[model samples]
Target: MSTTTAVDPTKTSSLRSGRRFGDAIFSALSHSAGIVILLVLIGVTFFLFWGAKDALVADGSEVRGGAGLIAYIGPLIFGTLLSSIIALLIAVPLSIGIALFISHYAPRRLASGLGYVVDLLAAVPSIIFGLWGMQIAGSAVPSFEFLNEYLGFIPLFSGTVTTTGRTMLMIGIVLAIMILPIMTAVNREVFLQTPRLHEEASLALGATRWEMIRQTVIPFGKSGVVSGAMLGLGRALGETMAVAIILSASGGGYSWELLSANTPGTIAGDIALNFPESFGVERSTLFVSGLALFVVTFLVNMFARWIISRRSEFSGAN
Candidate 1:
């Protein structure tokens, strides 16, 4: 009976109050972080909008809408999309393959080393890639002229080659290299997250390694792969230095024909190249181009989020 006395109700109440207080503090911190993020987003939108106001207005130009803005934005948007699309095409498959190798096939030691190499690649700076593209890739273009020549018939690659290497193809290749790390890392993580139970069950069902991965691993990780690729696409769309150094015709519209050497100018590249020298209306035009980029990137990210959300809902329902 002496040992049966419960702990003091007052002490228990105090402990509960303390936990509640700690939880409130943590909740406040999380809310503050979210508020800060919202503020930053708003600030960027306001700054860019304010900066580009003049360009959004109709000038005396034939185009009724913001001609200057359109003119400035025309090439940049195409270039950004073009380069990103190219990078995605190359990076996504390779990343999936590498991810599969690491997750299902490779020994632990080998997988770790390969993963480390991929992580190291992600750490490599854009400037370094740009420099390498300029120095080495540029020089090697001639050796690979067959690719250019074969594809040159396409309006996009019609540009004549010079001693200096800057071509759409070259820029695309450079972008592919730049985005590889992002896609690979994402793929690896998503694949690695495949539950041991699911994998073992798949194998026990007489499934081949590839069959297990295709049915179980990929299904589980598809959304993550898409997320990763979207992130890489964002990076590619905004890439400046490497594109600036690698693209030959970073100022004009798309080459309608394939294999055109003319480098389509991306919005980010144009801003980087011309913003410093621009003034008055010209500067405002650059801002307008930036606004366009902001819109497109925003839309792309929103679309990706929507897709992911829908997929998540579907998965949850199942």
Candidate 2:
């Protein structure tokens, strides 16, 4: 048989080199976009910190005298953390359960429809939730009167609503509702990403659907779930309108009443309430509060990343 002439290998190399050049150009552009985003963030932080430097200096003197920054942020920090933690406690499990149900328990058609509904809820304006919480949640305050009276033994639930009837519990519930959709959506996505093989293997071994989910799905998605909840918590911590609408400004500091929900206002709510026409020290203080919140949120996210990194080692171990 006559041998045909072989194609020149140099031509193939030249084509690959051209593609590599194009790829390098595209990658450089994409990487530059990320760097620009990072720089923007740094610039914003620097501006805010610079703007608040004077106030921080004022507060710093008190802190140096052994009073600590507590004098400036004690109430705001407490309110922000407390409300966020309560919202987290209520939202995380509910979101996870809803996510699981939608991901695994529901019929495919129903799951798609329900997921759309939940996503719609997420898109609803935070202002609407605030108004609804203020008007509707405030109206429901009387219903919890029994708990207020009996559970008054506990600080949280101890306080009664105003004659107009609104409490901190009302605010926390509003926050919970606002953040639930976020956590649920995140958890659902994570669960959906669970490797099918792991789940199939568990089911093939005569395990119940729930058992398979518990053993194969939830563990795999645990880090993602935590990250989602933490993200939701971050949103709740900085929620301004809803908290402002639901939480009145009267409460100054931590209250012992478990159901009081009325003790202190969150930093975001405080900023919103006070921002307009606020000048000098007050405005500076507000900026500082915002900075503190930013720091806390950043720390939570960092911790979540650390946890997520650890999960890779544990995910397939079982």
How accurate locally, in lDDT, is each candidate? 0.77, 0.80
Predicted structure with the largest lDDT when compared to the true one: 2
lDDT of 2 by residue, 1-318 (tens): 346566667565443544477889999999999999999989979988986776788755533223445655777788888888888888988999999999999999999998999999999888999988878865676666777777767666665545545556676778888999988999999999999999999999999999999998899889889888887888898899898877775655666443554467788998898889677766777788888888888887898888778757776646
- lDDT score, candidate 1: 0.77
Clashes of each: 16, 12
Candidate 1 residue spans exceeding 4 A from truth:
1-19, 58-67, 148-163, 313-318
Summarize candidate 1's per-residue lDDT along 108-155 as a digit string, tens digits: 999999999999999898988988888876576575466557766664
Looking at model 2, residue 64 earns an lDDT score of 21
